[model samples]
Target: MTSDRVPVVVAARRTPIATKGARLAHVTAEHLAAPVIRACVDDARAATGARADIGDVVLGNCMGPGGNIARLAALAAGIDVAVPGMTVDRQCGSGLSAIITAGEAIRAGDDRLQLAGGVESASTAPTRTFAGIAYFRAPFAPSGFPDPEMGPAAQALALRYDIDRHQQDNYAARSHQLAYDAHRLGRFDEEIVAIGDVRVDDGPRAGIPAMLGRFAPLFAPADGELNGTVTAGNSCRISDGAAAVAMVPAGSRGTTPGLALVAAATVGCDPALPGIGPVAAITRALADAGVTLADVAAFEIVEAFAAQTLAVLHLLGLAPDGVADPRVCAQGGALALGHPWGASGAVSVVRLFSRLVRGNAPAGTLGIATAAVGGGMGVAALFKVVR
Candidate 1:
C-alpha cells in the first residue's frame, strides 16, 4: 500500500446555517441535509468543470431514529441509485471521522470521488434518552465506558485547567468579537449559503456582555464551593444546521483545485475530562504533519465551551488569549454560530477551506479543525491550501 499522503482534494463545500429570522426557523429536518449536499456537489462541479460522479456518500449524524439518512440525502440530491451511501455516528467527531474514512478509501484505491460530511437539525433531532433501567445497568455493571455528559465534562475541564469563570467569559466575548468582525468583513460569505434569503448570522450579537455580574455556575454545588465555572455565556448554544464537503482525488483536472486534506488524527482522553480530547488529538496531528502549532496559518477549534477552548490552548502552550492568525474562524465559532452537533465540525472545515481559497493565503498554509466528543474523544484534521 502506498504510504504517501493521499492527495485528497476538497472539491467543494457548503453550509446552510440559520443566520436570520427566528433561530432555526428557516430549515426543515428532512430537507436540511439534502440542500447542503446538493450545494456542495454543485460547487464542486462548477469549480472543477468535471462531471465526476460521486462513488460514495458518507454522512455523519448523531440523531434520528431508523431513517437511512445518508441514502435519503443522496437521493434527494438527485444522485444515481447506483451510488452507495452510509451513515456513521462518532459523537462530535462524526463529521471529521467521515472525512477520514472517505480519504482513506480514496487512498486505498477503492473510490475516487466521495461525498463526506455531517448534518444535524438540533431543533428536530431528539435528545439523548436512556431506555429501561436494565439497559443502563447492563453497561455500567460490567464496567463499560460511561458517556460523560457534556455539561459535567466541561465543568470538570474548567476545574482541572483552572480556567476561571471570568476568563471563560472573556474568551466567549472574543469569539463574538471575532465572529462579528468576520461577518462585517464578509469573511463568511463564501461558505455560508443564505437559507431562504437570510444574509448575516443573527445569533452573534454586537456587544459581548462583560462577566462582572454575578451569575449562577452551570454545574457547581449549591453551597458555592467555587466549583461552578462553566456558564451559558461561555458555552455553545444548541443550533440547527447542516454542512457538506465534496472530496476528490488530488491532481484531478480542474480550474480551481480545492483545498487538500494533508493529515488527520483522533485521540481518546479520560472520560472524566472529555473536553480535553482535542488537546491530545491536536498534538498528535501536528506531530504527524511535522508542523508546530506556530506553522498553522488558521485554526477552527469547535467552541463547545469557552473553557474547553481555553484549556486546549493552555495545554498546547498557545497564546492563552487566542491565536492571532487572521483566518482563525474570522466568522466566529460554535459559540456565536451555534453548535449543531454533527454539523459543527464539518462546518468548521468548510469555513477553513473558504478562507484558504478566498483570502489566497500563503502556499502550504495549514488549517486545523478540531472537535471534542461526549466521551473524551476528539478528532483533528489538517488541510493544506491548494489552489
Candidate 2:
C-alpha cells in the first residue's frame, strides 16, 4: 500500500458510561452505539458543512450477540445500507483495535471515510455458557498459555510486583478525585452524548474513605501468601457504553481533522502477566513514531486495574514508584469511569481527542491511547495534533 494518504481523526463522541443495570440497562449494545454513531456523523457534517460520506463502519464488541453488531448499529443510526459494516473482537482491546484497523486502512490509501469505535452493553448481554457445559466465557486455557480472568491476573501481578493494598486504594482514590474534578469542570462535555437520563459517567464517587482498606480482597488466592491488592475500588466495574470516531485521509476532509495517526502497534506478551504488554507495545509505537517518552504531552492509559496501570506507568518511566503520575490519565480513567469491555479502549481515544485536540494544549502536541487486553495482548496508538 502507498502512503499517499494520512489517517486523521475528524470527530469523536461517546454515550455516558453507566454501571451495569443502571440508566442504560434497557438498551442493547447496538441500541447504545447507534446514537453515538449518528452523533459523530452529525458532528462531522456540521464541522465540514457537508455529508460525511462515510463508506464503512467498524465496531468492536464483546459479550454481545454473535450477529454483526456493527451492521445493526449502522442501520439503526440511519447510515446508508450501501455502506457495509463489520465487527471486530480483540476482547478488551477490541475498541481501540477497530480504530487502529480503520486508521491503517485509511493510511494505506483508501479513499473512503470510515467510522470506527466499540460498544458493550453488559446489561443486555446474554449469559454465555461453554458448549454443552455450565461454565461461562470458557473452561480452560490452551496448552502452554496460563490464562486467568483479568481480576486474578491483576492480583498475581500485584503480588509479584509488591504493590500493596494501601497503594492501590490511594490510586483508586486519586482516580475518583480526578474524574470528579473533570466532570465538575465540564471537561467531558464535548465528548459525552446523552444516553437517556444519564449525562455524565455514573461510576466515580468523590471522597474515597480510609475504610477502603477494610474490605476483603475480591481476587485473593487461598494459597497465596500475599493479600491481594486488587479490589472493587482499585479495579474497573462492569459497565455499558459506546464510543465512535470519524476518520478520513489527509487533506481530504470537509470536516475539521484533529489528530493525525502517526504510528500504532499491537503486540503480545506472556499470558500470566499480560498487564506488562503496554510497556513493550508503547515502546515499539514510540519508536515507530520517531519520538521518545518526553515528546508525549499526555497519556490515556486504560486503568483496567490499578496494579496493572501502575506497572505500565513504572515501566514507561512515567512513574518512579508504583504511584500514578499526573500526566497519565489526568482526567481519570477506567477506574473512575467504569470499563465496558470493548468500549473502554475507544473511550481512551476519545479522551485523548478531548484533552489534546480541544484542550489548552498547543498544536503539534502528542498523545497516546494504550490498553492491555485479555489474552496477553496490548495496543498502543500514537497521535499528534495537526491543526
Candidate 3:
C-alpha cells in the first residue's frame, strides 16, 4: 500500500520440519536457522539479481536461548557481521509478526534487502519449572478469566461451535492424506532443505482413516460427560524447524516479485477460546487490504487443532471442509506438518510464496496467512503475487 516503496517477497525457503525429540533434537535453533537463512539469501539473489550485501535480518523466536538468536544465526550463516539482526517474540504469532514488521520496514524504505523469518527448537529448548512445584506448557488466559490449556480450550471452542468428534476426526484424516499425497508428489521440495538426516517433515502419518474414531478423549476424565474432540491425533504436535523469506522493495534490482505484503493485522480476543481469535484478525486484514474473502485465491489457516481450524472456518462462513477446498491449505497444513511454535506462522508465509511462485498458481493471485495464538490472540497477513 505504500507509494514510496512496495514490499515484496523475492524468495523463501525452510528447513526440513522434524517432530520434537525426533531428528532435530540435537540441533540448536540457531543451527537450524543458519543454513536456511543462507539458502534464502542465495535464493533471493537469484530471484532479484542483487549483490550479496543484504541489509538487516529479523527473526522470531520463542523458548530459545536468552540472547538474540537472530544475531547468532546471521553469524553462523556467514552473513556480513555488520548487518545487524534482531529477534521478536509474540508467542505463537511471533513468526508472522516478524514478517509483517519486515514488510512494513521495506515499505518505509528502511532497508533494500531484508531477511525475516522464525525459528523454533522445541526439541532442544530447556524445560522450565516453578521451583519443581509445577510444569506447564502455556496458559490460554492471563489470570482473571478461566484459563485452560490449549486442548481444553479447543474442546470448549468445538462445543461452542457445535463441531463434533466425528467432524474433527474426518478433518484429521484429511490432513494426513493431503500431506502424504503432497510429500509423495514432492510438492514441498522447492521449500525444504535437509537438516542432518531429516530430509522431509517427520510428522504426518498415513492410515488416519482407520484410526479416526479410536483416539481417547484427551481433556475429559473417565467418568466425566464432556465429549472432548481435541486429541493428539487431531491436534498439531510440537516440532522443531526453521524457515526464512527474503523481502525487498518491488523495483529493487529488477526483482520479479513473487508476493507483495498487502496488509497485516494482529488482534486479541477472549482468552477463553483462543482458537476463534484468527476470525477477527483475518477479517481486519482483508479490510485493510481493500479486498474481500472472495478475492483471496488461497488461504493458510494454522491448524493448531482440528476443532480450532473448523471453528474458525465455520465462524467466518467459509467451508469447514477446508481439505476439499482447493484454495484453503490445498497442500496440507500444520496438523500434518507439525507446529514449531514460533516458526509455524512463517511456514505459512513460505507456503503462500511457494504456491504462487513455484508455478503452481497463476500470477496476481491473492493469499492469506492466519493463525490462532495462545493467550487469546490472532495474526493475519495478506499477500498477492506480482510478476
Candidate 4:
C-alpha cells in the first residue's frame, strides 16, 4: 500500500516438485532452492537489461535442516557474499509470509532487489526427537488445546462443512487432470527451473478420475466411527521443491509484465479446525485491495487437501466445484502438482505469475495467492498485473 516504491515481482521460478522419497530424495533443501534462485535472478536481469545486485534473500522452511537455509541457499546460488539472508517458519504459509515480509521491506524504503520464496526437502528432512521419544511434527497448539493431526483436522473441516467424499474426489480428479493437461501443453515451461536431472513435476498422473474412487479414507470420525472422507487420493503428496521470485521497487521494473504487490494479510484461527484459516485471510486481503472475488482473474490457493480447499472456497462464496471455475487454478494446483509444505505458498505465487503475467493477461489483471497453514493460520497476497 505504499504510495511510492511499491513492490513488484519481476521474475518467478521453481524447481520441479517431486514426491517425497521419490525423484528428489537425495537433494537437500538448500540445494533444491539454489537453482530456482539463480534462475529467477537471471530472468529479472534479462527482463530489465541490468545485472541484479540482490540485497537480501528471505526463504521459508518447515522440516528441513535447522540452520539458516536461506543463507546457505543464497550462497549456493552464487549470490554476492555480503548479501544477508533470513529464514521464516509459518508452517505451510511460510513461503508467502517471506514474500510479504520482503514487500514490507521494499515499502520501508529498501530499494535494493530482493529474492524471497520457500523450500522444502521432505525427502531429506531429518527425523526429530524430544527427550528419548521420536516425534513426527511439532505441536500446532500447546497443551490443553485441541490440535488434531492435519489429516484428522481436514476430515473435521469437511464434515463440519458437509463436503462429501464425492466432492473431494471430483476436486482431486480435476486437479490432476488440469495439471496433466497443462504440463502436456507446456503451460509450465517458463516457470520451471530444472534441478539436476529433474525437469518436470512427478505428481500429476493421467486417469486420476478413474482411480479416485478406489482410495480409502485416512482418518476416523471424532466419535471413533468409520468412513472419514479425507482420503489419500484427495490430499496432496508430501513433496520436495523450491520456488523463488525476484522482486524490486515498481520504479525499477522497466517494461516487464509482472505482478505488483497490492495487498497481503495473515490471520489465525482455531487450531482444531485449522483448514478454515484461509477464509478470514483472503477476505481481509481482498478488502484491503478494494476488490472482490469477482475482480480477481486468477487464484492460486495451495491445495494441501481437497477438503480444506473446498471449505475455503465454500466459505468464500465461490462454487466448490473445481472444473466449473477455470479461474481458481487455470493450469493446476498443489493437489496435482504436489505440496512441498513450506514451499507451496511461494509456488502459489509462481503459479499466479504464470497464469496472469506470462499467460498474456491484460494489465491490471488481478490474482490472489493464498494458503492455509498447519497451525491455525492463513496467508494471502493480492496482486495486480503491471505491464
Q: What C-alpha lDDT values do all the predictions have?
A: 0.73, 0.85, 0.83, 0.90
Which pairs, if any, clash in model 3? none
Model 1 weakest 10-residue run by lDDT:
133-142
All candidates: TM-score: 0.89, 0.95, 0.94, 0.98
Q: List candidate 2 stretches off by more than 4 Å.
A: 1-4, 139-141, 209-211, 221-223, 254-257
Off by over 4 Å in 4: 320-324
Q: Model 1, stretches more than 4 Å misplaced?
A: 1-7, 19-28, 127-146, 197-199, 210-215, 221-227, 253-255, 321-328
Single out the weakest 10-residue window by summed lDDT for candidate 3: 220-229
Per residue, candidate 3 scores C-alpha lDDT tens digits across 1-387 of 454477788888899888889899999999999988998889888876667467788898988875899999999999988999989888777888888888888777765688998999998887767767655464555568866678888888777777778888888887888788988988899899788778889866787667867778788622366656678888888999999899888767474767888889999998878888899999999998789988998898878899888888887877544433567787888889899988888999998887787855666799999888888899999998887
In what order do the candidates fall by lDDT, top score first?
4, 2, 3, 1
Kindly list the per-residue Cα lDDT of model 2 for residues 66-177, writing each as its tens digit. Answer: 7899999999999999998999988888899999999977877686778999999999888766655554464225867788888888888777777778778888888888
Question: lDDT by residue for model 4 over 30-107, one digit each (tens)?
Answer: 999999999988899999898857889999999987889999999999999999999999999999999999998998
Model 4, residue 241: what's the lDDT? Answer: 97
lDDT by residue for model 1 (116-150), tens = 88877666654344652222111211247655567
RMSD of each: 3.4, 1.8, 2.1, 1.3
lDDT (Cα) of model 4:
0.90
Candidate 4 clash figure, as a count: 0
How many residue pairs clash in each candidate at the backbone level?
A: 0, 0, 0, 0
